[model samples]
Target chain A: MNAVVLSPVDLAIAAALIVLLAALSLRLRLGVERQLLVSAARTTVQLLLIALVLKVLFEHAHLHWVALMAAVMILAAGREVSARQKHRLAGWWGYGIGTASMFLSSFTVTVLALLAVIGNDPWYAPQYAIPLLGMVLGNTMNGIALGLDRLTLDAVQRRAVIEARLALGERWQQAIAESRHEAMRVGLIPIINAMAAAGIVSLPGMMTGQILAGAPPLEAAKYQILVMFLIAGGTGLGTLVAVSLAARRLFDERHRLRPERVGSRP
Target chain B: MPVLELDALATRHVGPLDLRIDAGECVCLQGPSGSGKSLLLRALADLDPHAGEVRLDGVACSAMPAPQWRRRVVLVAAESQWWHARVGAHFPPGFDPAQLSAVDLPPAALDWEVVRCSTGERQRLALLRALALQPAALLLDEPTGNLDAGSCAAVEALIAAYRHAHAAAVLWVSHDARQAARVAQRCLTLHDGRFMAGVPAAEAPA
Candidate 1:
């Protein structure tokens, strides 16, 4: 066998695409460039680290370690949200949206992909389980971040309007309805745009990689559809949880919206 | 029954403080910036974390859900945020953009982006929103700071109307002696993060 193999051209094209994205972010002066840069760097380091550690886990098949890794991912993402919110509020929201939503949504996608899609083994196979779970959970984590950020910030800024709604007999949920819309709009827009522009605008990275590695067009398309659907599922569920939980922090026992922080007096 | 009560309130900036107001009364908190006048208002609203008890009509405010408490007891800051595209978009329900007419705004104001509103406009709109809610108590943090005479008159008239119609208890925070005299029924001065009785206001000068 001559070891008929895929060429490096596909890999080179992918690398170039990433480089262009980095340049575009800088050119646009998108303030979130830090988020993008850090996100990209983390992905690289995480993949490399996972590859080394996963080899051992794959060989030995340690269920405990797999569970532990999942927990670490959830906790780390939760803490990141905590750091941003920063307070007792930072605490409630971090765990509320970050931990509960992240873990619940991630676990849901993981189990579904495991049982129906990949056909889970007795001890979860690291190759299939970790990466697939990661894809769904990672998307959920990001949605939580986006949703919580918008919700918290809106609460701080639009307090007067919120109180007005309350005086008009609106409850926490009703008053927060507008803020929730803001959060959802910000959180879901990026993914919605990607979904809309996919295929026609450009072949997604996952599908393109599969095609480059000699998978047939139909096979790559199936993976693309699968990943996109899972992303939607993860984001939808995760956002709902994070927003609902974050809103809880705004209310007192009599069901009034509590202020996380007020302006400092002079 | 009192509309507002602060019993033995202990906060980050000050010690156990006590304040109370009856229905339809307006209490003014005035001091230099950073004297904790605003902090006291925030504490009463449970906006600032604190060790204190705040009661409204015999119910503990700190124990109530925050959004709900805010609904009934609102804070109108000097600069309140308007997040919508324009002046009219802030209303959650279909507020008949015509309501802006009552506030010196045209129906077309709805189409204008929020970036267009002047500081006075934001302050005015925030007050209008609070009045719209018909809150049981108002925690106003300088509602008139940015307004011109006309805008200020408009707000003053509305305050008088809300006081009459709703009997809402108002806690006004201001740095201006003139504005305090214009709006409040009674005034308390804040110094070193605590409330003291200010000089009696000139007879609500015409």
Candidate 2:
């Protein structure tokens, strides 16, 4: 049987809880009341807009439409990734690296899952392709953002050490090896934690949604496992690519540690 | 022929200057703060973007790989940095602890944590680290700036010995006229982004 659908009134009741949270925040002088309200409004508006777009997307189910939606999602994720950095590489490099890395990792994994694992007819079916790409891209974006932020920040803070190493005849890769490894570890941390705490500590959001939407529990669990593996692989690959590109950008071809290449947010 | 040569090298604030240091010679550079003494040294080491050319032993810096170029021409900045916890970890593999005595450092300094070393100790150790590379040329930016009188003398003697033994070309940056005279064969002062011959050591104002 299909799951019960919630009307606008039901969602409004949920939205009221957020308003109540804002009121409590205001009373407590938490200074987040305005942000809380604004964010809640943003969530409602953004999700609803996407819902409408997805309706049109599902009805068309054309390859080009699916590809266009995927491109928009990847671009938005790229912007978010760069925006999260405290010190980003100057110029298009800051945005381009993260966008390209996420595209390579997320798109490849989603397409592979569709064609080989899920084997959906046409292999680009909106029903399977969209959600799969969304999950992988979203998680990869977070990893890449964290990884790039850590890489740039560390490069700036530890400029002296890196230069000292460089001055001592170490190759660019050798000089930046530690910072790159640290960035990778930080990027993988969220997925590692999620995997460790899955099942016993909490049901993943996707699995819960599937179960609520009337999928059998076993099927939902299987899909969750698949998605988790896909996400882990995507995040790892994306972070690796983004961090490598960013670390290279921190230096010039001459192997100089050009921290000036990374500019602080104005 | 000069072992280390700078021909019209220029950085943002320092440049278009020419100089040469023959093998086994020490040339000290002096300048007022902000007059680009450090910038000149950085350029010599190829640690900063600069215009013009530098050569070691008639070999242009651009001719070799950067790391190879740097390995033969090392820069030890005024402030030393230690990335590893233990002092010895910063040194190259198979480094002899016996060399520490030449810098007046105890053999046990190698076992000490980097944080435990005083500024002067780190400075001396940094020099030893650079010297261990057996660089054909050395770029020293106030190598003894953080040291006491005794430590300074020790560093000078060690550097002098290293130069003598290896016949390395040394470009030493110093603010103290007396130290410059003591360590350098000839001294050049950077003023308004140009190098002028410094006063003879005896004629220099005390």
Candidate 3:
């Protein structure tokens, strides 16, 4: 089986569908006509740019280029995490926690999968390493961001309760234990939902994409399962690291509650 | 010797005043709401950012680790905070069951969920919790504010017993003049950031 290729005329036919959607949105005054058009344009440009870049990187097959791209993706994800936070640590600490957690979790999981599971030739194949790391980083980043944000916000809002524990000679770690637990629970929720719904409530994107590319159903299912497991592990690890680091930042060396260290969303 | 000493301790518009409480001394502190009375207690507890010095038994609060200082000088705020769902979970290991009974709380009070506790129960239970730490000094911020007169008297007696037994320095914040006179050996009123030796005249506002 071979995947179908689209010519310029074939693309025009798809573009016509988008135009109809935008026209209907305009007629109904849904107030999203401009957003729909802009999103369509952005989707086209971004995908094409990434496709071209990936093609070059795959052809050259250089480890340095693959590493650079992964670093860039991690950095962007880190910034997104920081931006999405409602309560965040001051200065670069906000971004640092997310970036460090994602880099550590995604890198370790991706490398382990490549070396032990896939065993691609040269092991650093751009095709496998880049896509796998990207998916892992995306999920892990959201988990870290959510966990850190919840931990910080909860600490600030529950200042009296936390300090009450501290007054009773509880260590800083002991005082914030409940909040940390809650944050981790919140962070892992998305991944848990996806795991629950996958292959039953809906077909996952990767499996569908693989089937579209003519891979056997069973082969695609196997890959999807591996990817899901990697994502869950990466997200859980990242969320835990992020919450721990963020919790440490909320208190000072003196065991005093330092709500000043946490800042409202900018 | 003084058990707790405040040498010109000052916070944002609160104090630059000196005071001393000898061991076993119960000094009642009265001030209007938002008069920085709570802030002063927090400063003494080293829970707030402040200047000057607070010494506990000749050891400077700054010199010791915060947890160490806090363990010795415990501050019970007006609003008690319950971290764990259950009451017993808040206390340290080896917490004497008798402490709960002493505060007029049932021994099974420990088994009740914190959310089910009445405000007065929390206030009294918080005092018991603080006393369990065996602090060298106790800072009470309207600890019995939510309790009825009977419960208030019971809590007062419990605190007096603890102070008598441990010789803990006490700074109890109270708005009621009668309660203050009944509970404290001496009274100190806060007005314009100064701690006056006796209650201020009615014309003098805090």
Off by over 4 Å in 3: B192-206
Every candidate's fraction of true contacts kept comes to 0.36, 0.78, 0.60
Looking at model 2, the pairs that clash are: none
- lDDT tens per residue, model 1, B1-206: 34888888877876478888788988777778788877777667666567878888889975677666766777776667664576665665655666666667677766767787787777777777766666789888878788888877777778877876788888888777788787787778777877776555555333
Which digits, one per residue and each the tens of the lDDT, describe model 1 over residues A110-217? Answer: 778777886867637777777777777767777777887778778877777775555444666777898898887777776788789999998988788778777888
What is the per-candidate TM-score for chain B?
A: 0.89, 0.96, 0.93
C-alpha lDDT of residue A67 in model 3: 88
In model 2, what is the error at residue A208, expressed in angstroms? 0.7
In order, what DockQ does each candidate have? Answer: 0.24, 0.84, 0.67
- Candidate 3 structure quality by residue, lDDT tens digits, B4-104: 99999998889897888899988889877777898899888887788999998899999998888889999998999887789998887898777687778
- Native-structure RMSD, model 3: 2.7
Q: Evaluate candidate 3 and give its CAPRI docking class based on DockQ.
A: medium
Q: What does candidate 2's lDDT look like per residue over A85-163, in tens digits?
A: 9999999999999999999999999999999999978889999999999999999999999999999999999998999
| Model 2 misplacement above 4 A | A26-31
RMSD of each: 6.9, 1.5, 2.7
Superposition error at B87 for model 1 (Å): 4.6
Which candidate has the top score in TM-score? 2
TM-score of each: 0.69, 0.97, 0.92
